[model samples]
Target: MQENKKTIYSWALYDWANSAYATTVIAGFFPLFFKSYYSADVAATTSTAHLGFASSISSLVIVLIAPLLGSIADVYSLKKRYLFLFSYLGILMSAMLSLVGAGEWQAALFIYILGNIGFMGSNIFYDGLLQSVSTKKSVDFVSGLGFSLGYLGGGVLFSINVWMFQDFEFFGFEDQATAIKASFISVALWWALFSIPLLLFVKEDKSTHISTTTKLKDGYLRLKKTFSKIRQLRHLSLFLVAYWLYIDGVDTIIRMAVDYGMALGFDSSNLILALLLVQFVGFPATLLFTKISEIMGTKGAIYLAIAIYLFIIMWAATMMEVWEFYMLAIMIALVQGGIQSLSRSYYSRMIPEGYSAEFFGFYNFIGKFAAIFGPLLIALVALVSQNSRVSIASISILFIIGAILLYFVDEKKGEKELKDALT
Candidate 1:
């Protein structure tokens, strides 16, 4: 089957749109804005703690319900509906950040938590749409294109925001706070405006026998059936376990690398520069990985990524020079998008027909829950050793475990199982 260019563009544009939140709010401005505006009266530690708590709340909410939502959406042909609801909710909540007043740390946390939920929950259905939008042969390339474009789109807006904040007066804003607030609105607009393409062009396929009864009763039974499918499908269980371990290591590195750099006496400027470098370099690097997957096979390419991460973590643990830090950043840029995009596409290929949304819910659940553990491991290791390097190096164990397990996942067998399940 030939790919639909319009649908592909629309799907890719959604990544370009929502990535502003990932870049600007999640990674860049929100922390500083929260500290400066909301916690001016309290200690910096208190504000930072609040941010972490809010983030945890968001993840917890999604982990508990993502599978249920995904299952229900699949049974009722509601992928686009759920996507619209969550995306708009996220957009509204993101824009509402502009309304938070100074000295309102509690309110800021509330809004941030809701906004994050809206953002993360929507991805369940978005990832599930992989089956609807592309073919098995093209999956890796399409998935890589989305991530590659995401890196480029997010980097551009983030850079613009940085420049705008640095020169508030030139942008006709009187103060930094006001300028930051306006940028929040910009993210909302950017996400909303670009999302129109997906909403208008792409559509979900609901060819399986759907429940004609009430959605509630249907959803419950559908979810139960999904649970049974997992029990019967050994390959899926194996893949999920493998993904949970490896992605934890991958995500932990992304979250901790900059902070670890800070711990090692690098300036904030150098750290931010590294973040930008990852986003930009990821554009081309993701495409390169797509080709690599085509030539070496998906599993082979993924194994390559795991091996590189093993080296990167060990290198970071022992590094001493500023130049070496840049090298570590470049290494991350090379493999970060590849690992995630490939993981998603690989999972899509293995899921039973018409169960993409429900199954992906479990996928997202493992991912979100595992995220909690990775950070905690680093924290525990740091407390015990009093050395950030020890904490960073300890994460490599997760990749090693994941890679070992990944070696056992037979994709050919998994595909056959999905086909039999559907028949």
Candidate 2:
């Protein structure tokens, strides 16, 4: 699994590929488009509710199957092949989004939900590839670099879309809505094109135990073993619980922020600008986090990031001014990518190399299920109180619980156990 530098860089290119959807569709245009166009007939809270529902549904779908898929992948040596399949599915769905005309919220919602599945499904395999991309000592740096590049790449595309949306006539588009749809196509194309390097270059180590029977049987056997082994893996189990809680808040903020701003009566342009600020700032800050992790240690650095998130959530509760939103974005920019990247590297370090795909599948499955609660909570709060602010504020409790549980994880002990298990 020790790969060359070329393999590592090619692997990182997938981040550049997929992040277009992260920035443009998720953060930049889709929220505003959903509110102002497709759901124009509904109240802002209702649109936000629908968006939350879509996110929750997508997460549920992945939650049901990610671990099983991961097990099958580990047994069948299907990681790279499946990554491409999911990536293409996502790309096609993203491209199809360009066809949704005005007042087609239902169509847009369905397509977006499917596309999200593809995006998240592909990422599970992508994260599993970390073991193949770099040595243990370099994993933190490599992981940080991937996220940093994603920010840069997604930001570049989003900035272009922002210009096109801002100057629709200059781009020779009939309207801003059309310009935004064009951006969806661009995101899809960029994803498909850049994914070529990884597809062509980066490769997985072949599975040692090839299944003689059907994949379902093979996967079931592996999955059964994984479940039985789970109880013995104390630190990994504790970390997943902590991750579910904290990442619930983290992902809630990512998925709901633009929508939150929209319901707050913020201008779409201002919100997009805030999104851009996070992208540009997050790029360098992610690298800085790699350095910080080296100095403070992974768990320490993660705790520091979580503490800052606590302050950020508290600040989010009272933010009313556009300037305050901008400030909040800056704070998030500092920790967002770092926490995510470091979490990936730290988890990779603790898992048995042979079971990486299956373990990471469980990891991502937990993440997806954890995502369901935050959005549901936010949507219900918004529905009941008819105020986006209240729902947004409630996310802080997840971070609080997560940080507390994270303290119980013994990293060295966990790594030793996983290594011993592999032996």
Candidates in order, TM-scores: namely 0.90, 0.97
For 119-153, candidate 1 gives per-residue lDDT tens digits of 88888888878778888888888888888888898
lDDT of 1 at 154: 84
**Maximum-TM-score candidate:** 2
- Tens digits of per-residue lDDT for model 2 on 209-246? 65446787888888887777776888888898999999
Candidate 1 clash pair list: none
Q: Which candidate leads the pack in lDDT?
A: 2
Q: What lDDT would candidate 1 get against the real structure?
A: 0.81
- Cα RMSD (Å) per model? 3.0, 1.6
